[model samples]
Target: MSKIGQAISEIQTLENISREDRWVNRLHPLGKLVLTVFYITVTVSFPKYELAGLAGMLLYPLAVFTVADLSFGDALRRLRVVLPLVMIMGILNPFFDREILLTIGRVPISGGVISMLTLMVKAVLTVLAGYLLIATTPMDEICRAMRVIHIPKIFVIVVLLIYRYVTVFLSEARRITQAYELRAPKQRGVHYKVWGSLLGQMLLRSMDRANDIYESMQLRGFDGNFRLGKKAALRPADFLWPVLWALVILALRLFPVVELIGRIFV
Candidate 1:
């Protein structure tokens, strides 16, 4: 399949995963959303050179992946895009921070090298935390969770619209690509010279598609408020998971859990 087709398929697969009868999907969206936010915050709060503590933070994603029964291979494949961006973000850290942090046997390890590794680990774990939420919770459920917590009505609606539009725009672009490929069968992907015109045309097509989608929504009486399927009650028991995980996360963040564990082993 073409790259564009593969991209569309990946998106659909993610949507399917969210709707699957997985363990994580079985939980209350609010619980998952809240804990996800807390987890990311804790992960990001670590100091750049605190690599050991940051390494221990991998427990969150590992726990999520194990509970959710998500595929590790698929997770790594998805990381390809993020890996480049993360490297670019931290590539210069080594040069900027040349402080001799410590000596490993003979060679000195600088603060920049340590911090760069820390930043990259933080980036991977944070991204994984987010996708774990998406893997288990549908976009609508997330939006509903936000509303339940008293987010502004207009903002909720806007979020839903943007999420819906992504699929619509992707569909429009895919169709355009197919037509271009049919006309220029010899070319591999869109030519560089045509990128500007192709994107401009895509913009026009997207706007028209958006208008059609809006009209359809209006015809279906889609008021600013979304009406989702009758969600099961978010029970008191539902709060247990997030609360427990959050406590563990907080403790790890405030205290040196990694060092304590290492001391015990040593």
Candidate 2:
């Protein structure tokens, strides 16, 4: 399959996973959303050189993966493109700060090296936290949670439409590429000279398709707001879920759990 085809398949797979019957998928979306936001906030709040403290933050993802029956390897593979981009954000940090922060045996680790590693960890943790939320919660539920929190209706609508129609956009692109390949069967890829014209054609076709969709939505009474059925009543577990995770996250942030564990063995 082509790359665009693979991307569409991956997206459909994720949507299927979100709709699966599982305990994690059944959790109130608001609680999971709040916990995800809190997790990312705490993960990024750690001191740049405090890598050991950051180690404890791994627990949240680990617990979620176990309970949700998700594969860390699969998550990593799905996020392959994004992870490298995130990790690269810290690539130049090692050259900027060279002061030695500590020594292990005969080797001295510099502040820049520690900070770079810390940044990479933060990147991975934040990305995985987001992936966990999306993997377990359907987009409609997530949008409902956003509306519950009083997010702007327009913003919510845009997000919902974008998520729903991105596949349409990709499908259009795939068709365009396939047509080009058929016409230029001997060519390996689209010629640079035709890139602009192909993109223009794709954009026009997408806009026409979008307008028809919008008209259909209006006929169906879209009314500028999503009616994602009745909101589920918040259960006791919903209340307890975020509170429990918040306490654990706060504890990890406030204490050097990794260092203390090492000291115990020492």
Candidate 3:
């Protein structure tokens, strides 16, 4: 398939989680947010050269992925965009870090290179954790979680609107590309000359759609904001998941026994 077709297909796949997946989806969104932040914090707390420590961090997300019944391949695919950028940053480290920090034969390693690798792993794990959370939890729940966590009403409203409209923007972009392909006698790379007008037309159409959306909202009595009424009460499982994962992360990072096995295997 063409590049645009591939992109759209991926988007549709990511949007496919349904209410039946509620075991993972039913977790309070705030709980998921807290867990995501906690996981990131623990992963980033280690020294930059601690490859074993960083690799050990993968267990948490892997276990969660299994429990959630989420697709590992799909999550990795979504995360590919960030991974290449991390790899590129890691590749650049050797130039600036000329000091030979370690060696395993004739080959030398630098502090910056080690640090970069650690950073890359940290970034990848954190991003994967985020993707996993979003994959299992709906966007509306996430926004509602933000509200429950005492985020400002304005910020919550803005986030909700953006989440609601992002699909619209993407759909419009795909339509524009399809139209371009249809009218042009031959397919061509996006030319500089047509870009401005093409982009302007997309923006114009987006604004028109936004205006109609605003009108509809007003008719529904939206006065700059809407409230998500509290539905799912916090359950015993909600508290248990975060607390349990927090201890697992702490054990992996702090206990020498866990670290030793992690070093030996990972």
Candidate 4:
């Protein structure tokens, strides 16, 4: 498939996953959002040399995947493009921080190496937590959770519209590409000479479509304020999920859980 088509499919797949009738998907969005934020904050708060403590943070995403029956391999695959960039953020750390902090036998490990690994772990855990949240929670529910937290209405509306219309924008681009391909058969890709004209046409088409969408919204009584249906009352599970996870996360953070476990066996 073309790259654009693959992009569209990925978005649809995420939407489908969120809509699945799984227990995790059914949990209240606000609780998931809270836990995700808390998990990320704790993960990033660890000391640069405290790799063992940060290692314990992996439990959160692992539990979610197991409970939700999500494919860990698939998640990693979908995130392949992003993981490299995140990993590279700390590549220079090893060069800048060369203090010897510890040794295994005769071999010495520098502070730079530990900190670099620590940073990479932090990046992976936080990114996975975010992906899990989005994979399980629909965009509407996410925005609703934002509203519950008192996020500005304008910001919420902008987020919702951008997500909702992105597919439309991509679809238009795909149509233009296909038409161009038909006219210029045997070309490997779009010619540089036509790039500007193609983009101009896409912009014009997208603007017209946006105006029509806005008019439709007006006819349907879309005021400046976006409205969601009456909020659902919070359930017991909604309260329990975040509380339970928070305690586990805090215990891991405050104690040397990984090191203690290693002592039991060694």
Candidate 5:
């Protein structure tokens, strides 16, 4: 799947993004993790048709994107892989609920339409917020932060392995897909007949590769313990950053700043 390749490349981009020397990259990973949870919680709590309120959620991610000196284009490029799925998820809303709700200027909008837009915005904001954390904060830092917070070792380990190895899984899948495409060049796509055998082969190949990888790790003394760097020192910003994000989120949630600006201009 092209989506698989996109995910693999996305992780590579995240690793590169984490190396940028920026204020966001310097913030304590624990702080970012807490704020990320807060953000998603508040974002999801919004009513299904509250699109204006959801617009405000964008500010936090945009601010982080700027402060981290991250590439918005690269982020959106990866996000494209997700947009179609969200669209499909919400596509039935319009057909199912056709109640007339509000007007944008002279144009009437239906409840279902509003809800669809809300879902899309919510999807984008939540995904971007999570990616912001991933891009700026290294995987090891997140595991260390989880352990610091008394999170279960098994939970942390599972999360760490999933993040680290999903890319490997996708990489294997991509290689298999490429091989299939080359072999079946006369066909538009992999033939339906080959799908099952293709997947089985991919599984066998991936397992063998994974075993080799594990053995290599054992040779290098992986020891099941993910080595984390010295705990990042807490600075004043560590305390201030989460507070600022919370305040901004609350302000945007409680009041439609966008509507207020519209009124001032009107």
Candidate 6:
């Protein structure tokens, strides 16, 4: 209904994907992390011009999103926030190389266009994979996974602090936005210039809140780093599922029967 309500709902949907309950959620966060990394590695390893390979790479993350009860639509919508930047970075490719690579009817397509298309696909797929990973795995588990993988303590501490504070800042942002809408009834366009002032105020408030949180943590005897109580243990199912998926990914990548057939027929 309300903008604030919608934002909260979207965030909740993105953050929680364990709707099925038991088994999948119980898998070690490290396992999920490893699988995600594997997917990205294989996807990007293909030649940039291999459209078939790039398209095929979508299967893994899509299937995972479906089975894990993740929100594909919501993730795509969130991705729109950064798509403009991606497009800007890619725009120059077409201009730099006008050499004809292919033709449809009378119009010719250049290598630049093909490369740009590949870049866009890779960017979107990788980003969506990352979002799906976090959506299915909680932040606490991710930090614990990083530690288990022997990531440095300082990096883990920074990640944990960011995770904790980002939400605090988001809440503050939502409150300020709501307050602005209420105070300025039906205002539009140039009137929103006041956001600059509001932004500065919010920054000051955020700094104060961060200081208070630091003091609170110190009082609780928080050492320089966090230690998760116990690492998540792997179960038979956890080990089996990821391995099976990895095998499937590898088969499709190496074999690519569908692409072979397409090239032969077309």
Residue 229, model 5: Cα distance from true site in angstroms: 2.2
| Selected candidate, larger lDDT, 4 vs 5 | 4
| Model 4 agreement with the true structure over 187-228: per-residue lDDT tens digits | 988899988888987788778988998999999998888887
TM-score: the better of candidates 3 and 5: 3
Mark the regions of model 3 whose C-alpha exceeds 4 Å error after superposition: 1-7, 94-113, 185-188, 262-266
Q: Residue-wise lDDT of candidate 3 within 106-215, one digit each (tens)?
A: 88888887888887888879888988777777777888888887888998888888866766677777778877878875867556889899999888888888899889
Runs of candidate 1 exceeding 4 Å displacement: 185-215
lDDT of 5 at 209: 79
RMSD of 4: 2.1
Q: Highest TM-score, which number?
A: 2
lDDT of candidate 2 at residue 146, scale 0 to 100: 92
Candidate 6 has which clashing residue pairs, if any? none
lDDT (10s digit) by residue, model 5, range 33-61: 99999999999899998998888789999
Estimated TM-score per prediction? 0.87, 0.91, 0.84, 0.90, 0.80, 0.77
lDDT of each: 0.86, 0.89, 0.79, 0.89, 0.84, 0.77
Q: CA shift at 51, candidate 1, in angstroms?
A: 0.3
How well is each residue in 1-266 modelled by candidate 1, as lDDT tens digits? 86767877887888899999976787899999999999999998999899999877888889889977897677677778888988998999999999999998899999999999998888788888888888889888999899889999889888888887677677777888889989999988889989999999888877887798889989999777677679797776678889989988888888898999999998
Sort order, TM-score high to low = 2, 4, 1, 3, 5, 6
Name the runs in model 6 displaced over 4 angstroms: 1-9, 18-22, 92-95, 103-108, 177-208, 218-221, 254-256, 263-266
Lowest lDDT sum, 10 consecutive residues, model 4, at: 74-83
**Total residue pair clashes for candidate 1:** 0
TM-score of 1: 0.87
